[model samples]
Target chain A: MPSLNHYLLVAGLLFAIGLTGVVLRRNIIVVFMCLELMLSAANLTLIAFSRFYPGANGLPDIHGQMLVFFVVTVAAAEVAVGLAIIVALYRTRQTIYTDELTTLKG
Target chain B: MPLPIFWLFTVIMLFGAAAVVLLRNPVASAMSMVASFVGLAGLFVGMNAYFAGIIQILVYAGAIMVLFIFIIMLLDLNTDKKRTPKMAPILGGLGIVIAFTIQLIGVISTTPDKAMPALDLPASAASFTPGTQIAKNLSANSLPDVHLIGQSLFTEYNLPLQILGVLLLVATIGVVTLSKKQSN
Candidate 1:
């Protein structure tokens, strides 16, 4: 059977890949995708831990799964607002390149 | 049997993640990310967390991915198409080395010797009906009920849940204001 270590390793790899994307990509949308990737990596770790550890009752600790629920809810709200902002920025500036959209830079 | 399935899903997830990063087309990347979410859901199922697995598919693969694709389609991003230039081979090598080092550290920190009791016990010890013979006869790896989650969410974490609702409401208002043609 695959152990918890295997899942943690996969999560770490996902996080690293996501980090690479964030660092290397210039597109605002791609960067957001990378951010989602990072969140998913954290969710994987939480789920793995939940599986390995049971709560005080005989049930698997619902805490990790519950947290993932909240994370998903927040992520959805974030994307909704973020995409709206991105769309508005695109409408105003006609560009999605992160490097080019530096109007607020000091 | 379970191990092989787990390996298969893991490979699928890794491949999908690679596609998400490496694909030039934003739409393709979003689609690949959806595939990764599906693979993750499969992994959850393998761990016997059926509710979470189903929710993963529904929320991430179904909803969030659609939102990503919608944004990709809405943006019409053809003007900015110059691909990022390839980095020097030495830099790429260094990146790999750093990734490996981090992975090694994670492995060391989460070693089996340091495993906590919270995660090592049988599921039965944590169930509500631990004394029942019927509960004992039941499979040790059954998924928790969705209704139970709802109950716990409302009862135990009600305050945080209410706060999240408020946050969502604020986000919705902000999005509306931002997307509007003119401020009222």
Candidate 2:
């Protein structure tokens, strides 16, 4: 049985890597991809915690998994809208680079 | 008594995440994300969150990534790959790693043993009468899996579930309005 520390560390490392990608990547789509990575890390942690703490008498406490379900649903909706927005922006601006899409900057 | 499968999936996940950062093409990065998601799902399954693991594959790797790749193709964006930036962004990325390293250390040292607030567990409420059909069904649970999720989702979280439905509907309309080619 891998200790809680192991799972937590892996999830944390994954989140850090995703964060680094988000900060450094200029391509908007890759940044969004990295964002998904971060979300996945959070989901992993939720399931991990849920598994470890099963409440009284060894019954599984599934609240964290419950939260993960909603998170996944929200993520799906968010990605759909976000990709649509990105595609529309690409149509209008001919570029998906975040630095170049500064027409609204004042 | 460690699980080899957990470590295996963790290693794969880290490798995929690194590829997501290092790959030049956005399509490649998105594919790496799918690999990472699958690895995470494997971990979830190992942890016995079976429904979550399957949903991670279906909703995340399946639907969301297809949306990403479709958008990438629609925009013809795979052709304009650029080298990863050198100085400023790298420094920024390094800063992020350092900051979250501290957080990891903190979380590893701390214990989260408190009883998280309960969310109207079926046994706690008075609404369901013991002899009533609803109460009998609600009280019955073989295991923590999809059926349990369905019961809790419809009963305890019914309002939020309805709200989520509304949110998805709104998102669909918004995407159509936002991305639809301008009507002539």
Candidate 3:
């Protein structure tokens, strides 16, 4: 029975690692994946809070879980649009490296 | 309350996250993200968020990861050869250590669930619900979580549910138009 603190700690670590991945990775797709990882970390924290932090009446709070729903939906929507953009970029440039995509001027 | 199970999933999740950062190939990174999501989903179930846990696996591990794999395969990406050496690990390790220490301090000093003062207000005090039979039943917590979620979404959060539907529609159209091949 790991406590709420343990869950929060893991979620924090996940967020930190995801942030590092975003900063360090050059590939656009990999960076996108890291962003998704960060979103998952946030979702974990929300779920943990929803479970452990009961309402003052002592019933489980479902608000945080509901928010997780919205977050997951947004993450799905982001993946769809993001992957499409990545594919479009690959078609035009034949590369997915973020470093090579220096200019918007064409 | 199985501590060993909790430890097991946490290790898998952290390992997958590290692999995502370290792997050279985008495909491998995507696969590792799947592993991490699965572990997180398991934890969600352990915490009694059965609906969210299921959705995490279905939507994230299933749909999102498949989409990533599809794009990676479609691109036929060359090996990401120009790896940034050592800096990510060093900086990432430092950031993780600092964050862990801070969180541990909070965990040990204060009681768990004490940080969210906003949630501590009685539901009756809020306009959401007074201390009624329904709230009492909920306090007992015997109702299935999915059912409660469904009931709330329709009654209390209907407007937001509609908004989410619209957002999904927009995302679908945006993806299609963005990816379409322009005609010569």
Candidate 3 lDDT, B28-146, residue by residue in tens? 89999999999999999887788999999999999999998988888787455665566755687567657765775676457544432222323433433646545554555443568
Q: In candidate 2 chain B, where is summed lDDT lowest over 10 consecutive residues?
A: B112-121
Model 3 / residue B103 / CA error / Å: 7.8
User: How accurately is candidate 3 docked according to DockQ?
Assistant: 0.51
Could you give candidate 3's per-residue lDDT for residues A1-106 as a string of tens digits? 6777788888988887787788777788889999998999999989888877775544458899899999999999999999998888888988888767878856
Residue clash pairs of candidate 2: A1-B1, A1-B2
Tens-digit per-residue lDDT, B61-86, candidate 2 = 89998988888888888786555557
Candidate 1, residues A1-106, lDDT tens digits: the string is 7777778878887787777777777788988888888898898889888877766665567888889889988998998898999989888998888778888999
lDDT of all predictions, in order shown?
0.77, 0.81, 0.81
lDDT of 2: 0.81
DockQ of 2: 0.52
List where candidate 1 sits over 4 angstroms from the true fold.
A104-106, B78-80, B84-106, B113-142
Candidate 1, position A99, lDDT:
74
Indicate whether candidate 2 or candidate 3 has the larger TM-score: 2
Candidate 3: deviation at residue B84, Å?
6.6
lDDT of 2 by residue, A1-106 (tens): 6777778888999999888888888889999988989998998888878877775534346578789999999999999898888888877888889878787899
